[model samples]
Target: MNKIIWLFPFVLSTLYVSAQKKTDRKTLSNLQMHVAYLASDKLEGRRTGTPGEQLAAAYIAGQMKDIGLTPMGEEGFLQTFTVKEGREPAADTKMSIGDQILTPGTQFIPLPFSAASSAKGEVIPNVNEPDNIWLVNVSEMDITNPHESMANQYLKEAKEAQQAGATAVVFYNSKETAAEVAEWLDQNPAPIPVPAVWVNDAVSKKLMADDAEGFKINLQVAFKPTKRTGTNVIGYIDNKAEKTIILGAHYDHLGYGEDHNGLGTATKEIYNGADDNASGTAALLEIARLLKASKLRGNNYAIVAFSGEELGLFGSKYFTEHSQIALSQANFMINMDMVGRLTAEKGLQIGGIGTSPAWNTILPAVAPKELKLSYDSAGVGPSDHTSFYRKNIPVLFFFTGTHSDYHKPTDDAGKLNYDGALSVVKLVYDIIDKANGMDKLTFSKTREPQMGTNARFSVTLGIMPDYTFDKGGVRIDGVTDGRPASKAGMAAGDVIVQMGSLPVTNLEAYMQALGTFKKGDQTDVKVKRGNAEKVFQVQF
Candidate 1:
């Protein structure tokens, strides 16, 4: 998730500035050089699991090696993880009714939950004969219930057919209806026992036209699993201390806007996320250099360049779960993201202030007078810092704010504020230095904020949707107090399966369900908690 901070203007007292320091020429040059290469078109926006992301990881590793930081990853400085990149139809996937061959993607399409096997038998329309293909017609089904899922309906029908010893199940609509078969094609569900497929309206009409007699059908539903590997670069300055401080930044960006997460999705343009994260990664590199050469050795330092942050904090989450370093010895974590576009006001947004009491004292003392800082007390937000906060660790997230060029091709290296970024690096270093004298900071739980305010919807469930959940439905990461979700007893980790009369299949479906309601509306929200499904009455 992107760090979409909703800025509220605030400033620190000028008394905090004890002295003014000159900007180092070498630091500025290094920041610019790092951003220039990482955000350049040559890196293709450094999308995770791509060659571009690998190149960026290699470069960060090289920089860490040059700084003399000890490699801390499972493989030298690289920690790799596998990501499920959806699925694709195999070459053998085909369907035919006697001599009439049907196209795979157009005339007929296999659902993601279809069994990867072949089935052949005689088919009779609207017949549930044993050892025969079942042709289920959904033309007369009551699909008007908003809470009902067409995909689920198809799966239920297929399951019933399989129970009757059917060879396979095929779904189609004989008449015009609002329901679409294509909508069920992309859903991720558990595979059924037998092959299942959906045919387009043209093929459906052809099948129903010949329902008077049985026909031999040959069907195959085969899919190849699509996957990619994301790598995290880890380097440690082992001061031989009892505690370790972590510094992290994500280097992945939207590659040619292929993931549909970018602002400019209509064009095949490389979304060079300079301000989005390249700037933060550059700052991390410079910070590693400073810490490696610093005399403050009260705590060990772990510098990490994470990937797949734009894809729901995959890299950081993976590291925290499968860390080589002792997490129990972790002091705190500082995350830098989108720290390149500092305004003339020197505005900087810092989150997770409420995560630790030490931040309340250390931040104001070490902050420079030139910088106008706004703070969010929430320990959970749309960034990698939230991952650490979840583990009962203190966290701080630094960001300059969003811009018009955010998540677009226009966000290039030339637009970065090198001097401003360098200042941010210095401020982080100062905070670390001030905290060197203290013991590990105490962790505190704070309220989680909503992801963002979307203009498309007027009402909100007041929950942060977990973006990493791919199994189906929208999983709640956090629930805001005094909101609809909280009032209805919705808690974090609860997967919302239905909203009112609408079935919530995915994040987009959940958002659409939100748009259907208004203030003062009351509805029943169904969520899956553990092995049980519960319904809560919510008033919006």
Candidate 2:
């Protein structure tokens, strides 16, 4: 009887220990496999539509199949879509102002959003006209400093000029304002209603100084829009529940060190976004494995590996718009982004806590002692979760926060905290457990955070500034196709060393430099293309 009792406990303990070792091995091995492959050099940073991205999609789809999850995408496990990637200037372009012939890429740049058409007419300052080209001088406006709201005004005025029957609009402003206008153009895929040009202060003054009467302007610009393909891998675990839970992670990263590479380093080097997404992606796969193996399948699970997220939630937005499974049945969504870098102290940052009343309550209860939860109420941030939140669906975003290696070639798999990632996966599993089979979560709208603003000013630089650049100077990730920066031949990867007479050492300095200019002003912008320094004149 004593042997029976002793041996029974020993046998049970041995089996439990063996099972634990097996689990530990599986967890680490599975996570490592996913992150290693997804963030490996062979994947080539997995930019949307690229061969690397296709490979990633195939791998994810294969994994979904292995998990016994049914395909929840348009085609098997893939939901393919086309998006306007970017636009390039087409030939047959011309611009002239009376006797002065404006050279393309030197005197004026066409905004990417500008329509491909020809327009010629007398130039008049802020005059609403159908046949006349309107001249907008920033000096004439109430702009006194750099401000985010003022940046919108530039686009608003451009739309107004188009609506007022103006054939084109010419803006004269400071380098800062021109940068802002350029940025706005690059961001909005919609074409501008009319031709637009941003001339330097010198050009503005020269034009304004001349007689308004018989002042003719002629311009022609053609933009060739580029299309890029991306895929969203979706798999479903249906428990016949009316309300479903969604788990998502972006698998795309900056490809071949494009303009979006925050550090502005390495033009062609692969940016293997290991922690930026590979970690999150790995977590998703691990969670799926757990869910598949678990007995508790309370609610339906729709797990997605989104693509084109680096470009702006393209996959998530597309999935939400054309979901194979009705999004109306989605109770809530959990997004894992940049969750690979979780530290013992920093733990995890859970954004979108205010997105549902249930999150704040359920999070603490489910979170383990190992994790310290930092909460953020705002649902709208720079990730795919924002796409679902916009659809009135509650969301929870898991992140480990930014790191020194963010958006750079240095974000490789070797640097990921695998153990931390596994914990996050467990946390997600618990979160699902807490909400599964429950009544649909009440979606609450949280106020959106300020869009790209750290300082208030009147003037703006028109290019989309890469905020994550770890180096000196403000890095320009994207230039509006037809705005001042584009006209000035300034492009992505150009580091704005100086704007006008002020040094732009960082984003704050860049903003400070912008506040010094008003409308109808012009300034010289110095940029470092590589080791070479180049100067371009920008008008606001």
Candidate 3:
């Protein structure tokens, strides 16, 4: 009996040691494997609702299954959702104003946001009648002013035209306005509330100056809206505890270098968002493995690999709203995003710091010495964590900061700091370890980050500057329709080397130079396109 008792203690010790090994530092090889496949070109950027994303979802589900986690999704490990996909305009679209047939590219272009509709009516100046087509001139409107004001004006005018029962509205603008509108269409390529067309200055002049009896307009705008499918992978460990802890990571990224990509130069390159999210997804898998091997106390665990995050927070939003376990039973949530490029000196940026009081004390206490930390009290930012915060749940967001390759095709697996990511994951594990047996985390409201909800700039160049461009000049990725940059003949791939007399070396310089210009100001903007330096006149 004495010998048996001694052997019982030895057996217990062996089991404990084995468990410790499973929960210890995650293997670098495993991280590499997950990242390699997730960010591989074969996956084609894993865009939400695409076959690539479906493949990634299947892989995550397989990993969770291997980790011995119970499926919590509607279909085994999958929580599927539907989204509306917009179709491109048909090439055979036709439009005519009076006796003149307008060319699609040169004289006028149908806004991509227009729904499929055909209308023929008398062309009237402004919106006086509900049955007529309205024409509004925006040549005098200052393009350099804040977009909110200009956008507000467009909204106000469109609402009036709609209220007047106008079937369509034609905007008369300069070449700049045409370019600005083109850029806007690139970013918001979906059906708008009203049908609209943008016509050049010459067309506007002919409409206003010519005899009114024959002034009629006809247009055939085309678009098709279809349903798209998306999936979210949910895994769980039922500890039968009162509250559940959640861990999540977004796995979706931009595909084929669309409007979101900060194109260094215009070319069809796949945006492999390895660091943007593959790193976070890989970390999620590693953490799930560790948690499966660890013994929990008084709480269940749920891990979600979210899709449709690039389009918005569709996966997290759906899960929180339709979770099998009530959201009220959620103890807290932690999110990992862009954790691959962790710079030791810069450390990690932990958002939603003020969401829980315990975090203020607990985070500092358990933070590893090897990891540097920056805290943002805001619970609201541009990520999946915001969805949980809206539910009054305490949340923590881990980010490795932004870089030149962010949202660009160059963001590949080779650029990731693997050791740095390991440190970050370890820190997250320690935080969880401390909170294992604690009471449900208390929720607190945090001040929203400035960049969260507002555009702080005094003026805009009417162009979308590539936020990830590290080059000498501010690279124009998308020019807004009817904006000054468009008026200045600035196109995508054009680098603004000089704004007025100011030498623009980078994004900051460009913004600063733009601030110096006010509404109605005119200046020469210099751009580097190919090997040639071209200067164009811009009216702010």
Candidate 4:
């Protein structure tokens, strides 16, 4: 420990070190209090752009100010942005559909970012009649090899039928249908450029029956697209601007869906996102408190809590890209996503190990061998860190693997494994300390092949699967993001029911059709939802 100097601030580094023992417990307790409130149910999973999220931002900013960290942006401690999504008035409104009294709330919801309007449209290419192709959900896995999945086959069939000019694509719900459907609807609901609506068992049968004459649908929905604010809560201790270490976490999760595990309505249950991200946010605050007490004052470390991670890492992406200072100020970005739980009570998954050469070298020096640091050769995965990685920044994402509770209401704080989280945080803290003192540790990308399953594959398809399509054959609510579907002049409202000679019924079927072809494969993908039956070529 260094000695104190006369009349100098923080000159007594020795005083800070010995005092660490006396302050550890109290500091940790304070951190726990802040995290507890941030992760509470009142925040509604801290969904981006929601009222609950706004409340969370206020709470976090207050905590940051209390810690004396400078605001990193013009908007106080908040880095704000808007995320577009589909939503409709709760299925409780009343309206008129031809002679029948059309109900507003439950039958349809406004698509995310759909134009605000009062819509009245007739059922074109009516699928309720016999002979119209309909989409249905199925479950057929390659159990013989768990590593290999044929999930895309379902989507392939739907694309084929849409090309055939199928009148409608009715869909069947899956085991995770409720949550997935809500997500689908939130991203892409019906009735923008084209007309589409979701139907339950009774409504679907009623519309399909011939007796359902004078069948007209009327809807009044409102959509707003002005601007919104979000935040990434951060606190720092800067003692003369040194190299930095970032302890970061995303404080967002998938909000409540249409149904909660098929047991209760989405409104009744909350997707607490406890493990999904609440756990990560909690750790960030705790680490700040720890370092503050330890007087680890040389480095300019930031403990950040990010928002909008569920809706595609919006908040973290903003902070890293639009920093007040240079992005290179920090040596490493250590992120914790779902570190509250451990699989088999034996290991934690550490992706990005293969992404950086330095990770492979330094991991052994700081982390336990038995704890098992896992990795994907590709440093990039579907998380907030991907934004940084794409920018050629060295990054690490900590995950505890996925579970049944992922993206579901069951992801509650009551289920969090605190001991597991503590262990992981301790391990990460050590890693940062080791890296902080190193002289210019250079990081290189590791382009390793993926091992087991491929969630997405690059194939020629000019259709977008709209979760809000509410039809069969892997409902097409929108076109693939930045794919041939978008380039071939396809729009979000267009649903693809068929591809080439195959019908895309579900994600599984869609995968199977794509599997039959190699790269540079071109084919006619058919999208027929909401009276628009057209075929487009998807070139590989």
Which scores higher on TM-score, 1 or 3? 1
CA lDDT scores, all candidates in order = 0.83, 0.80, 0.78, 0.59
TM-score of each: 0.70, 0.65, 0.67, 0.62
| CA deviation > 4 Å runs, candidate 4 | 1-35, 85-95, 108-204, 207-229, 258-267, 295-298, 368-377, 448-540
Model 3 has an lDDT value of 0.78
Clashes of 4: 60
What ranking of all candidate models by TM-score puts the best one first? 1, 3, 2, 4
Stretches off by above 4 angstroms in model 1 are: 1-23, 85-87, 95-109, 119-141, 148-150, 160-193, 198-218, 449-540
Q: Candidate 1's residue-wise lDDT over 104-128, tens digit each? A: 7678878767899999987766666
Poorly placed runs, candidate 2 (over 4 Å)? 90-223, 450-540
Which candidate's lDDT is highest?
A: 1
Task: Report the C-alpha lDDT of model 2 over 1-540, residue by residue, as the tens digit.
Answer: 998998998999999999977886798889999999999899998988899999999999999999899998889999999855555556666788888887655466676557778888875554556767887775566544444455455667778778877788777754543334434444554678687767766676676674655577888887655667899999999888788889999998887855343443445788899997989998998898888887666678899999988877889999998997888888899999988887776668888999999887788889898677777787887899999999999999998867657767788888988888878888898888877656789999997643255544444455777644648998886665455777789988899989877888877677777776766579999999999999999876
lDDT of 3 by residue, 290-313 (tens): 778778556788999998788778
Give the count of colliding residue pairs in each prediction. Answer: 2, 37, 15, 60
The lDDT of model 4 is: 0.59
RMSD of each: 12.0, 10.4, 9.3, 14.1
